[model samples]
Target: MTELFDADPQAAIAAYGTEAISDPLDMLSRLTAAAAHTMEAMGKRVNDIEAIRYENKQGGEQIRGEVKLYMQAMAQTGKFLDMLIKSGFEERKIKLDEQTAGMFVTAMQRVCARLELTPEQTVLVGTVVPEVLRGLEA
Candidate 1:
């Protein structure tokens, strides 16, 4: 790729104490990918918990048992997301932009699918944005 020299000087000064954002767009891309990777690593952890659910359940009770565990995780995720949003908005004066909102939609979809949650379990997990859910499911 060509060298990207165009960096917002103001942002660099604020965030990095530099004259310009050294890598600019490349830094954003790297950070985005790193965040995605971290989430993936965290996702694998749910499997370990679900495996315990699987072991403790009778064959026919597999769905019910795992759904319970799944719901607990989902509820915690929702609470954490809510807290993060509040913290960002209140403490940092950061509002959720459309791009971040769309990202949250995708993340909700991915987590739901990863847990293989049912409709009832979905309700227990909360966060039912009609348009976002519909679009994700579609």
Candidate 2:
């Protein structure tokens, strides 16, 4: 097996060959696999909760009923994703409102001045700040 170096991409490519280059679908497949594994683990947790519920019932103890909350969370997450898809949220180009964007830029400018950032560093921050702020929910 080839020993790959993450820090040195050229060396990693030389060692592992061009097959090391990843495509979107490859990444998506890996993500899907991880999600499936997570779901399986969550299923086991639900089973454990059911066992606890059963034991508490047999012993005439009060059930904590965490499984209901867990199921609700899962259902809510699914509904949220479904709504996002149906609403074409990802298809639209979303951006921060100008007022909020200006406020963020002004704050960052103050931060840059306080930190005494180099002119180039300040410029770099100015360039990326808008995109970064837009990525977050308001």
Candidate 3:
């Protein structure tokens, strides 16, 4: 149990004889253990961040799919409404000749005169008309 340090204040660390230690491997092993522990902690942190990123990606994809489905449903509803209107006109035995078409167009214009719609919305509604006719045929 020789004291590891000497009373001499000026004694360099090299002057401490290494013979007192039975094995230098113990110091190396401790150093390796500390490094391994630090590496393990860092690996776990990276794994957690990756998992969070994966979840976010999946959630974003799911939201996109839901939005697509909602748009399709809206389109389908619009088509159904258009078909109902078309069928009602057909039930009246009204042929869609140029004159009838003009009259109907004018009537619709008068009906929507008070309400304002953007050109895009009007185009969207117009696009659904053919789909509604197809649906009615089916």
Candidate 1: residue 122 Cα off by (Å): 1.0
Candidate 1, TM-score vs. the true structure? 0.26
- Enumerate residue pairs that collide in model 2: none
Model 3 local distance difference test score: 0.53
**TM-score of model 3 vs. true structure:** 0.25
Model 2: how far residue 74 lies from native, Å = 0.4
Candidate 3 stretches with Cα past 4 Å from truth are 1-96
Candidate 2 deviant stretches above 4 angstroms = 1-51, 55-64, 94-138
Once fitted onto the true fold, the runs of candidate 1 whose alpha carbons sit more than 4 angstroms away are: 1-18, 21-96, 127-138
- Collision count of model 2: 0
Candidate 3 residues 56-116, lDDT tens each?
Answer: 5445523233344445555555555455455464444344466687786687666555567
Q: C-alpha displacement of 110 in model 2, angstroms?
A: 23
Q: Model 1: per-residue lDDT, tens digit, 31-125?
A: 54555555555556656563543333454534444455455555655555555555443343234466687798789778988999999988766
Clashing pairs in 3: none
Best by lDDT: 2
Clashing pairs in 1: none
lDDT by residue (8-76, candidate 2, tens digit) is 768876775655545543444455455555556665777776354544546775544556655655665
Q: Please provide TM-scores, in order, for all candidate models, with all chains considered together.
A: 0.26, 0.29, 0.25
lDDT of each: 0.57, 0.62, 0.53
